[model samples]
Target: MTEGPDITFVLGTRPEIIKLAPVIRECEDRSLTRSIIHTGQHYDESLDLVFFDQLALPEPTHHLEVGSSTHGRQTGEMIIRIEEILRRERPDTLLVQGDTNSVLAGAIAASKLDIDLGHVEAGLRSDDRTMPEETNRVLTDHASDYLFAPTEQSRARLRSERIPDERIYVTGNTIVDAVEQNRTLAAQRSAVLAEYDLVPGRYCLLTAHRAETIDDEQRFGDLLTGVGRVASHLEREVVYPIHPRAAKSLEAFDLDVPDGIRIVEPQNYLDFLSLEDAASLVLTDSGGVQEEACILGVPSVTLRESTERPETIDVGANRLVGTDPAAIVEGADEMIDRDGEWTNPFGNGTAATQILDTITGAERREVSPK
Candidate 1:
C-alpha cells in the first residue's frame, strides 16, 4: 500500500486545458493525488471556464489570476505566483503543457525549487525565434526533467539540441487523446452547425489570434482579404470565431472584415470542435487548430510562414500560406482538393496513459537501486 506520487498540473489557456484533460482524468481514474494550478492567462469565462465544464474537468486547486500583460510582466508574475504555490504544496512533480507563458513560468519555478518537471508536447520547433512561443518552447525543453515529445521528428529536434535521449520520450501528442475523448460527445450534444446554419463541408473555419498575425495590422488585413477571396471562389462562408484580443485589434486597426467572412464570438469547446469537424477546410494561425484539423482528417491552411507541427504538412493535411492573400487562397484551394488519406502521425488515443506511466515509472526508477 505504498502512496502514489503527488503531481501538480499547471496550465493557463484553453488549449492547454483541452490537451491536458485526459491526463487529469487518468489521474482521477488511478486514484492518484493530483492538483491543478490555473494561471488565468486566458481570463475570459467563454475562453476559460466553459472549457472546464465542457471537458468535465475538475476545478483547479489554485487560480493565480495572472491575466494578460506584456510578455515579461506576465511571465514574471506567473513565476512569482507559481513559485509561492510550489513552496507551499511541494508536489513531487510539476507537469506543464504547450508553449504558453504559463509553461515557461512553471518550468522556471519548478526547476528553481528543485522539483522534477515534465513538459508535455515538448521539442516542437518553428525555428522562428521571433515568435514568443518559439522562445518559450526552447527554454522550457532545456529546463525540463522529462520531455514528452509528440513525434519522432520532435524527438530528433530535441536530440539535435543536445537534450539527453534518456530524458526524452516519444509519447505522442495528447491532442489525439482529447479529440478522441470528446468528438463523440461533441457530435451528440453540440448544435453549433445547425445554430449557425452552416452546412457540413461548405464553410471554412478561420482563427487568427497569434500576435504575429493579429497584432500586425497589415498582416491581419492581408489574412482577411485572402480568406475572403477563398470564400468567394468557393461560394462558401468563412466562419471566424474571433478571440477577444483579436476583436480589440480589429477595432484598433479599423480593419473591415470582408464579405463572405462571417464573424462570430468565441465558442465553447464542444461547439468549436463541432465546427472544426464540419468545416470543409480550416485556415488559421493556431497551432492547436492545425493539430485538431489533421486529427479530424480535415484540410487546413496555416496562416503562418512556419509551424511547429510540421508533421501535419508531411502528412498532407496542412499547408502554410503565411499572410499573403494570393498564397492563402491558393493554399486553401490546394488543401481543399487534397484527399485526407494521410495517417494521423500524432498518436493513438492513449497519450495520456503513456504520459502518466512515464511520470510514475521515472519516479520508481529514481528510487530503485541498480
Candidate 2:
C-alpha cells in the first residue's frame, strides 16, 4: 500500500512555532506523514530551541535559513526556498500560520504551485495595511484553500472580504491549546518565577516588539518609559521577557530600564506560559500574546494603536493603550483594579484537533468527491 503525501507545516518566528506545535502533534498521532519547514525569518537559534524544547515539537524536517533581511528580500528568499521544498516534497498540502512574512511566502508559493494550502490563525485583520502583518494575514486568507479562524470575529473579517463561508471554520486557537496543555507543566517544572524571585499574580508581564513600536525612537521610548512609570506607580515589578529586537531597540534609544523594572531575555515557552498564567495583567504589542492572555483569563493592555484581535477588546479582555506611557500606566492600573473578571473569548482550547479535522476532512472530500 502506498503512503499518503506528506503535509508540510511552515513556521518561522516564535509565535508560529507555539501556535502550530499542537497541530504538528495531531498530525503525528494520526500517523499522517508530515514535514515542519522552518524559514529562519527569526534568525535566532535560542528562539527556535525554546519552542522546540518547551513544546516538545519534533525538530524541523527542513530549514530554509532565509534569515533577517528587508521585508521584500526576506519574503522573496522564503518564496524561492519554500517553492524549492514544495517542488521536491510535492506534499499534499502546506500549512502556514498567522501574519508573518514566512506565512505569506509559504501561501504564495503553495497556491501558485496548485498545492492545497491551509492557514491556521487565518481570517484575522486589522484593516491597516501600514502594519505589514495585517497585509500578510489578509493576503494569506484569500490565497488559502482552508482557513482555520480562531474566533467568530476572525471569521467575520474573512466574510466581509467575500471569502466563502464553506472555506472557513471557527477552529479556536492552538496557542490556547498550547497554553492549556503546558500550564500544568509550567507550574510543575518552571524555575522562571524563581529566577526572578517573583510570585505569580504579583506583577505585570510586559513584552513589546512590534516593528512599529520599536522602529520609532519616540514610540519605543514611550513604551519603555510608560512601562517603567507604570511599574513605579503600581509599586510592582514589570517583568519584560525582552525579545532580541526589542532589546536592541531599547539600546538604540538609550532607554534605561528604570528602577524596579526587570528586563530579561526571552523565557522559554513553558516558562513564559507560566508567567502569563500568574501575571496580574499583560502588556504587549504581540497579536498572539493578546489572544493568549485572553485564553488565560488575564486582562491585557495592548501597546499598539490598533489590534487585529479586537474581539479581545470587545470582550473587555484587552485595552489598546497605544504607545503613550501615561495611557499605559493608566490602562495597567485599570486592569489591575478591575481584576480580570471577563471570561476568555478565544476558546475552550481544542483548536488543534479542530484545525486538523477541518483540513484533512476537506482533503478527503476533494479526493473522494461525493
Candidate 3:
C-alpha cells in the first residue's frame, strides 16, 4: 500500500485529546485531510466526550469503544480496532501522542502494516518499568518512524536507546501551544474560580490518579493527608477535581477525605486550565498537568517518585515529591512562595506547525533515505 498525503491521529484520554487539538486544528487550517480515531480508553463522559466539545474539535472519524478493562484486554482490542481503521483508510502516517495504551496500540498497528508511524512527545523515560506508561512510551518510540521528542533531553534519551538519529526531532512539546492558545479563551469563557468561590493565589489545586499512587490505600491516604496538611498550614483550600478512577478507589478503600481539602466533580479542559492558571500551587501525578503548570507559571508539586518531564524540575517550576505527607507538605511550602521566574521550556507555541512541516518533509525524505 502506497503512503498517501493524508494523516490520521489515534487519541483516547483527555491529555491526548487536549495535546493533539492544536495539531488537528493546524491540519484544518492548512486544508490538509486528516482522520481522528478515538479508542474509547477514556469512556467516562467527563473524561472523554466533553473535551471534544470544549476544544471545538471535529467528531472522531472512528470511535472504538474499548472502555475500561485490564491492560491486556484494552490494548489488544485497540490494536485490533485501530488495525481495521488503518486498513480501511490507508492513510500515509498514523500519529499518536503521550504514553497511553492507545499510542502503543496505534504504533503497533501502524508498524505491522508498513504505515509510517509518528510518536509525538516521544523519548520520555521515567526509568520505572513498573509504570505501564513508561512501557507504552518506550515501545512506541522503537516502533515509530518519526519520534517527536519534546526537548533535547528527550532526544538524547532516544540516542542513548540507539533509536536512529534520523528518526528523532526536538520539536518542543505541543502542550505549550495548547496552553498559549487556550488560556485567553479559558480566562474569558470559564467561571470555575467564581463557581468554586475561590480567590486566585489563595487556593491550591490537587489531582492524583496514577495507579502507583492510588492503587494502594496507604499511599493514597498519605497523599491526601499530606495535601490536607499543606492546605491547613497555608490556611488555603486544596481543591481536588476527582478523576472517576480515583473516586472509585476512594469508595473501595473507604478512605477519608481529610479536612482543608474539598472534593469536586471532574472539570472540563477549559475549567481545569482556569483553575491551574489561578492556583497558588498545584499537586498532581499527571505529566500533562506538570507541563501545564510550568507553562502557566504556577508552581507544581508532582506526587510521584519519578517523572519523564524533568524539564519542569530543572526550570524550578516543579518538585518531584513522593506521596509522603510530611514530604508533600514540605514540597508545597517550598514551592508556594517562589516567584514565577522560570522560563517556559516547551516552545513559542508553534509546535503544531513544526510537527506538520516535519511530517511533510519526512514524506519527501522517506522517498529517498538521504
Best candidate (score: lDDT): 1
- Comparing 2 and 3 on lDDT, the stronger one: 3
Please give, for residues 69-143, the per-residue lDDT of candidate 1 as tens digits: 999999999999999999999999999999999999999999898689989999999999999999999999999
Candidate 1 clash pair list? none
Ranking by lDDT: 1, 3, 2
Q: Give Cα distance to truth, residue 255, candidate 2, Å.
A: 2.0
lDDT of 2 by residue, 17-124 (tens): 988888888887888889889998888788875678767888999888888999999999999999998998899889999999999999999988868898998877
TM-score of each: 0.97, 0.95, 0.97
Error at 156, model 1, angstroms: 0.5
Error of 1 at 240 (Å): 0.3
By lDDT, the better pick of 1 and 2 is 1
Candidate 2: regions farther than 4 A off: 1-5, 362-370
